[model samples]
Target chain A: MSDIFERIREKFPEYFRSSHSNFGDDTILIKPEGLLPVMGYLKDEEGFNVLMDLTCVDYYGEEERFEVVYHLYDLTEKKRLRVKVRLREEEPVVESLSHMWKNANWYEREVWDMFGVKFLNHPNLKRILMYEEFEGHPLRKDYPLRKRQPRVGPLN
Target chain B: MGVKRVVTGVFGEEGFITTKLDSMVGWARKYSLFVYPFVTACCGMEYMSVSCAHYDLDRFGAALPRFSPRQADLLMVVGTISHKIAPVLLRVYEQMTEPKWVIAFGTCTCTGGFYDNYATVQGIDTILPVDVYIPGCPPRPETVLDGIMKLQEKIQNSKQEY
Candidate 1:
C-alpha cells in the first residue's frame, strides 16, 4: 500500500498537493482541475473499484472554502484511499464522478443539496434531500439554524 | 321485539348497564381505533415492537393497522417528519375520515428530537393537530401503549359532532 502510494505520488506530482498514510489509511489531496483525471487513474489503473462515499465539508470564512471528499475502496486488493479536492468560496464546482461510479450520482446530489457545491455535467443536478423551493444551503456556516423556508400551506 | 324484551328485562334488573347513545358510540369508537402507522425513521422499530405480541397493541383494540389513510381512524405519525416529507404526511392526515385522531409517536414526531436542522420539521403539530405525544427518543413499547391509552381516553371524552 505504501509502495503504491509512493508510486502514485511520483506519477502525478502536478496533481497532488500533499499525500500521507496515517490512521491506517492513505489520503491524497488533489486540485480541483486534476480531480477527474486523478479519480479516473485510480479507478482504471490503480483498481479502486468502489466509490464508497462522496461528501463535502464547509470551511466557512476561508479563501478555499469547501472540501469535497471521496472515499474509494479497492475490493480485490482490500485497500482504501481518501481523495480530497478544495474549492473556492465563490464557485465551488467540481467534475461529477457519476460517469465513473454510478452511486456517485446520489452522493453528489446529497453533497450539493447540503453544501450548495455544484457538480458539473451531472445527469440530474437537483436537490435530492431538500425541496426545490428551499433557500440557502443549510449546511453552509452562514445559514442560520432558526431560519425556515416554508413551501407548504398552513392547515386551516 | 324479542331484543327489546331482553333489554327491558336487563334494564329492569338493579345496577344493570345504563348510558347515553353518544357515550355508547364514543365507547365503541374509543376501543375500535384503526391506526395508520406512518412509520419513517428509527422510531418505526419501536412501533413494530409495540404492535407485536408481548407488547400486544391489539389488547387496546387498536390492533388493526390500516395502510390506506381512508380506512384509518387514527394516524400514528411515528419517527421524524422532514420538511420535504411534511406535505406527504399532511396529505395522508387529510385523507383520513372525519372523527380522526393523531398520536405523535416518539420525540422526533412530537418535537423533532435532536435533529434541529433545516430538513427536519420542528414538530408535526405545526401541520396536524396531534392528540397524544408519546415522548421519548424512540419510546419504549410500554410508553407507546400508555400513549394509546391516553388517546383512547381522549376519544372517549370527544363530542360526537358527526
Candidate 2:
C-alpha cells in the first residue's frame, strides 16, 4: 500500500472496511456514511481534485445488491482511487457529491436514471438519458433486454 | 416525353395538349422534390456521400436539403429513431406541408436495424407513413440513389393532394 492509502486508513479507521490493489489500481470499500467526509478529505487534504466517474453495479440476488462506485484522480500526483459503497437493494441511497465536484450533478443523475440509486441531496435527480414518459429503468439486471414501451404517436 | 408525344400526335400539331391534372401535378412534384434530412446517427455519413458531387443527388432533383420541415416535400429519416426522439420526429412530420412523403433512409429507420431494445423504436413507419425503405446498415451511395429513384417513381404515380 502507498503512503497516501496508509494516511487515509489511519485518518478514518472506523469508516475503513477493506481495500485491494489489483493491476496497479487501488480500490477502497468504505461505509456509505463515510462517502461525503472521505471524499472531502481526499479533495482538501489528499489532493484527489478530480472526480472522474461515478456509477453503480447491480449484483442481483445478493444481500447488498447495489454497489455505488466512484473513481477519483489526483492531478498533481497523477494517481487514481476507486471508492465503493454497498447498499441494500430495498434502499439504494447515497450522499450526493455535487457540492464538492460540480460534475457530480449529472453523474448522480445518470446513476439515478440507469441504476435507480437515489442521491439524497442531488439538485435535480431526474432521468438524464431517457425520456420523461419512459416507465422503468432499463439498465437493471431484471429489465428484459427487448422489452419495449408504448410509442409516442397515434400509429402506436 | 411519352405522354406529351401521344397527346401531340392525337391533337395533330395543336399548340396545347390536354391531360389529367393529377398526372401533370405528379410529374412536376416528382421532378422538384425538396427533401428534409432528419439525420440522427452514423447513416448521416452515408447521406452526405449520396448528396455530395460524387454520387450527385442533384440529378434526381433531391439535392436540395431544407433544414426546416415547412418547405420540404420529402422527409428522409436517416438514422435510428430512439423513443426519446420519436415525438420530435412525429412533430417534424406533422409540421411539414401537405403532399409530403417519407423515406426511411437506412435499416435503422426502416426496421430499427439490430437495436431491438427498450430505447430504439422498432421502425419509423409505426409513427409516420413511409413511402420508400432503403435497406442497408448504412446504405451505399448507389443504394441510396436507387431508393431516391424509387421514391421518384412513387411520387410520379401517387395522386396529388393539390
Candidate 1 wrongly placed segments (more than 4 Å): A153-156, B1-17
lDDT of 2: 0.88
lDDT of 2 at B43: 97
Instruction: For residues B12-95, write the lDDT of model 2, one tens digit per residue.
Output: 776575677888888788878899999999999999999999999999888999999999989999999998899899999999
lDDT of 1 by residue, A1-156 (tens): 677767767878888788788887889888899988889999999999999999999999889999999999999998899999999999999999999999999999999989999999999999988899888788899898687775564321
How do the residues B1-162 of candidate 1 rate in per-residue lDDT, one tens digit apiece? 011112456456643455666667778888899999999999999999999998999999999999999999999999998888899999999999998999999998998888877778888998879989999989999999999988887777778765
Q: Where does candidate 1 chain A have its weakest 10-residue lDDT segment?
A: A147-156
TM-score of chain A of each: 0.94, 0.94
Instruction: Candidate 2: list runs displaced more than 4 Å.
Output: A153-156, B6-20
How many residue pairs clash in all the candidates, one count each?
A: 0, 0
Itemize residue pairs with steric clashes in candidate 1: none
Q: What C-alpha lDDT do the candidate models reach, one value each?
A: 0.87, 0.88
